[model samples]
Target: MRGFRRGLHRRSLYHRSLHLPPSPDAAHAQLLALHESGDANAAARFLREKTAAGSIFPGFLSSVVIDRACKSGDLRGALLILATMLHSGTPPPNQHAFASLIDALSKSTRLADAARALELMRDAGIHPDVVTFTVMIRGFCKNRMMERAWEIFQEMIKSNRCQPDCFLYGVLIDGYCKELRMDRALELLREMRVERRIQPDVVIYNSIVDGLCRSNRFLEAWKFLDETMVLQGCSPTVVTYTSLIRGACKAKKMKLAVRIWNAMLERKIQPTIVSYSVIIDGLSKAGRVYDAYRVVREMETLGCELNVVIYTTLIDGLCKSGFLDDAYALYRIMKRSGAFPNQRTYATLIDTFCRNDRTETALGLFDHIRDYCPLDVAMYTAVVSGLCRERRLDDARALFREMRLAGVSADTHAYNVLLHGAFRSERPEEAFRILEELGDDPGCVANLLTYNTVIAGCCLESGMVLFYEMRQRGIAPDFATYSALIDRLLGSGEIGRAFDLCEEMLASGLSPPSGVLGRVVARLCWSRRGDLAAKVIEMAMAVDDTASFSLPWDDEDGAAQDEDSQGEELGSIKDGATQEEPVP
Candidate 1:
């Protein structure tokens, strides 16, 4: 027996000396190592060169290569590998290999390519299984293409290749809930329970509960939790409670939010960092910062380390509540606790200081953090807007140029800020130059706010021209746009044109600003168009029955005068006016 064993070992060594290929597991490990080191292309090249030299790579190894390429976001490269596998046919690829490619393509929003990959899979004599169809359906749902997702779901069932599992039903239900199609979601739940006889899991219950809460049907959510979830032996998780808490906070029912929080604790469902963050943010926004702080303290006491998000939430609450000193102190604490402030934390501090007229401090903080965190558009816009508010247009313009040089493109909001600042500083020429620059930039499409700001700065004719230009650009005028134009026309004593604009504004389902309407009525009464003024008031009241108009007109006696006579005259005009001279 010993001699036989010795002979077998000697034969194995001799076979190794012939330079025989390594095992498939060893080859796969080499490819995975290459992928881990971020040299997936090198692995692919090695596989190709070896295969070209008559070396055979097993199907599983080939699948690993494809998976690596897809994970690296090189879907095209992965598909090429799949094509090579198809033609080479050393060992045929399996369902998992194509599934990897399909999943990656779906995640990248390349749904068309993903569908083609499925066709390729079929052409390669491989039918898609449950996992493949599930991935495709999820991709469609993520892209908000619900109809396509349903088609894929139906295809999976119609093919009878695999039955719809619990996970598949959960994905479709979640999708419907997210789209606010609660009716369809519940229908699926009913089918799962009655026809399929699949007991709804915790995940399915969570989706339904979250959907109901988001739709502000809190009572229904609670009823489902009590009747369906609890009765069906499905226990509520932290996510369910957190969803309820979020809904309560959004609806400004903090007392109910606290009750939900307590219920979660009573059930021994430990709050996650996300749950804690949501409650903290809600409390802060509700002006209950002290309560938020108490929760933070409780978290620390429970040995749950607070993250940067929690600290930032608290700091924002402090800043907005006019406790800048406290906010900065918290910032120091955050840094000391080994939690660095993110861009939002820095932006809040800088904006608060600037609002308090401490431009130098805000600038200093901005400069200190410029190299630490990547400065985003919001931070730059905040400082630019702050400088503009301080009437330091030159400094603001310099920073704007610096922002451009830094490759942070200025959006419409940034331009609007500078334009408004110029107008406020009585720099019409500079404002017009900004407008021209906006028109010249191909990347900067003017939005409604942009036109509104310019109209607010320009005179009546220029503003009217800009309005027409806005329409030509396919940008519909919003309420603010009409408000600015109507205010400008009424201020220039163009009552007829102002009334025409107001009528258009009403037709667009937007009410003019009450202040602007009051001004128009006062101007009409002052110009002895009392009949037109009364008609304007009537139209305003028609649009909103509870609308109130304050007339600031006075007689020569220096006392406020009643406009009852104006209403009487308005009635007479309405009775005798020609069709050409309409109420507007």
Candidate 2:
């Protein structure tokens, strides 16, 4: 009764198709359903049970199941199914199905599995079809395994079972082109024409041209394009012209691209969105925003509506040109025109706002995104970093917590914000606790900022003892770490100790910034050790030939220091009298 009930429950979940089709059809449908539902085990079980029940299993179904399992990356399951089909006296289907299995294995990107499938096909007395050869060749070429693909092609030719058609040649040409093996693609093309008696089509021609263009051989690609135009039976498609224009644009030969674009117009061929976007992106990247804008106007004139990507390009251009207000206005225009802002839009806005010191505006925009839109971790991190820079630690912490609650895993940048906030609140123990909490996250260990922030905190609150502890924990100190140590030592009036750190920085090939070196000089000057002070000034001059030092004095402090100095080596030069450096 329990078994019947379980069967009923399982039946309830399947289709109620009254007439049973062939076992292969039903099995194919069930397998497809299982794969769709992500129930690989159930799919496998259905195939086993039906075959065992003496159902008529077709060879094609077995081939498909094998292909399905291979493509799904379940090699063991595929082997089990293959064994069951073999035992059931089902012959492996037509050459097409066997080829499909090979294609599936190749698409899975498992070269060993593909090789094994190919071997199994040969052993079963099923020869690989043309599609099989093409797919395997393309797959090997994609992985830069050209040698293997070439060997298979040679073997296929030697077997004389199938002829290499135009499609096959196209596949190999495209594959080699994609791998940047232009020489191989060209050689294959030449062989196709002269040796194999196969003619070049637009696709084969385009593949060679595109490959040459990608290798920065625009001149070669162009020369080939002209050669293809004059080929006896080949005619250039719109795609051919677009490919040349795009290649020229990529090589930043805008004049050539424009000429091709005009030629395409003369031929009455329409430009695709990809072509427009490519030119617009290139124009914007090259700081030719005016040209990019002109393209947008041209697109409008051509009755092609501006897309979000086009507007984003315009916004980026405006922002780069120091027109943030204009960028913002264009952003508003983009929304009004029914283009939704994607993650890049948000990131650009946040970066622009922060750079303009409009931190509140950036945070407000971020807050809205946190409540709505699919959240991007990078966008959140950028905002968190801006808040930390602005010293709004509490707000930064709240956002960090919100990100975790939203099911976004806290990356190292988020952790850095929390550590910075903890330090801002003067809770070194809390900061240390955060680092301890991150011990389980392997990704956190690779974050240099996280390591630097925590190391800097240790140097500030605890000292080198914790700094060494951080090192023991496998956190390597960066330049910021050394700078923090120098800062802490200098703050404590340990100039000699600070000099040791300076030496360490120099040994590590880190030259402290001029501003930081200025601070060190100021510290020495205030110490009244005139000899050491002169040495620091001379060192600073040697490092920066253009730098000149002038002692800045406040009128009040100047009067006080002049009144107090009896001798250069006076112990406790009387606090009210010693010259204090003017605060900027």
Query: Which candidate ranks first by TM-score, i.e. highest?
Result: 1
Cα lDDT tens digits for candidate 1, 1-584: 99669757754554453454666445545554565567767777766666655567767667767788788877777877776666776775678878888999999999999988888888878899999988989999888788999999998889888888889899999999899888899999999899999888999999998988888876678778888888999888899888878876776656556656665665556789999998888788878788788788877877889889999999999988889999999999999999999988888889899988888899999999988999987798789888998888888889989988999888888888889888887898899998788778776877888888888888888889999999999999987888888888876778889878877776565666788778778877888988878877777767774333332222322333332211111111113222221000
* Per-residue alpha-carbon lDDT of candidate 2 for residues 193-290, written as tens digits (9 for 90 to 100): 89989887878887887888888887677766665544555666677776776786676655445556655655556667776777677667656777
Best by lDDT: 1
Worst 10 residues of 2 by lDDT: 565-574
Checking candidate 1 for backbone clashes, the offending pairs are: none
lDDT of 2: 0.70
Cα RMSD to the true fold for all candidates: 14.5, 18.6
Clashing pairs in 2: none
The true-structure Cα RMSD of candidate 2 reads: 18.6
Candidate 2 runs further than 4 Å off: 1-45, 52-54, 61-83, 108-112, 143-148, 158-160, 298-308, 328-584
lDDT score for residue 252 of model 2? 60
The window of 10 residues in a row where model 1 has the poorest summed lDDT is 565-574
